[model samples]
Target: MQYRWGSAWGGQRLLGTENIEVAIINRGRPLRSVVLEIRGRSPNGLPPVRMFQEIEELPRNREVRFELASYEMPDEIEELNLSIVSSTAVE
Candidate 1:
């Protein structure tokens, strides 16, 4: 899994927000579902914000992309952490 951050736009004007793009490559086997947890800190030094997303029916040796929620661009998120919350295999 790999993650990247970029500015989000609604149209011509900037939405003044940022969003994350995740790429997941299934190697071992097919999966029925996968839950991912994203955690990051704010620029203001406040508590971290976390979000979760679930992807279903992923096939083996396939790559999938996911777009996460948009957040304030100036949040100055220092680091991003991605974890596999849960996964189910396809039998």
Candidate 2:
């Protein structure tokens, strides 16, 4: 299945350190094997890892809340990367 990351349905930015909730919206056939991981880079470095989680099958076009992370405002996360390794991939 294909994976999409966002704060909501199709959001790219999660302003400030305010408990950001991310969802992995899936669209495609049922996935047999799915491995996904997200890493964020900030000026202060990894901040205690408030939340981190993953899932296997997410309904087509539906969003599955991956996890939540609390970040401080003006933190300006340098990078937010997601890598999904599965039977089907679109990247």
Candidate 3:
């Protein structure tokens, strides 16, 4: 899986104060279930903010847009890490 953060309209701006827009692409095999984790780190030395989303199903080479609700995102996140925590492939 691959992900990118940006507004739906354009540019690299965040969606809103309490929401994040992410575009995810499934480049590998079809999946029955998957858990995605996103970590946002700020430059001010605060603890990293973590968010998770569970995708029920993902087809190979398909793109999915997810608007994750974030209640404690820092105003200036310097770095973001997206990872696939777990996944189950379709048999």
Candidate 4:
């Protein structure tokens, strides 16, 4: 699995914006649902942030973009980590 920042606006990425966009690519089997765990530290001197998102019916060899918005948006994400908490494989 691979992930990167995504932008809804053409060619204009929101690097330091309130809303964060993440693009996830599925390189393996199809999934009925998947839970992604995200952890990062903000540059605003606040505590580390943790977030989770559940994607449904993701097909193989596909990419999806999810927007993350919380009470505080990190000006810059550091030591960011993404993990798969749970997933249902579609046979």
Cα distance off (Å), candidate 1, residue 42: 3.3
C-alpha RMSD of each candidate structure in angstroms: 4.2, 6.0, 2.4, 2.6
TM-score winner between candidates 1 and 2: 1
Give Cα distance to truth, residue 44, candidate 4, Å: 4.5
Query: What TM-score does model 4 achieve against the real structure?
Result: 0.77
Q: What ranges in model 4 sit over 4 Å off?
A: 6-15, 70-76
Error of 3 at 71 (Å): 2.4
Most lDDT-accurate candidate: 3
- List candidate 2 stretches off by more than 4 Å: 1-15, 43-52, 71-76, 86-91
The digit string of per-residue lDDT tens for model 2 on 1-91 reads 3444445334566564454555566666554355665666676765622223456555567766654444332354555666664454433
- What Cα-based lDDT does every candidate model obtain? 0.66, 0.52, 0.76, 0.74
**How would you encode candidate 4's per-residue C-alpha lDDT over 1-91 as one tens digit per residue?**
8888634453555565546678888898998778989887867777887888898867888888887763455456655678889999998
Clashing pairs in 4: none
Model 3 Cα displacement at 44 (Å)?
A: 2.5
TM-score of each: 0.66, 0.49, 0.78, 0.77
In model 2, the worst 10-residue window by lDDT is: 1-10
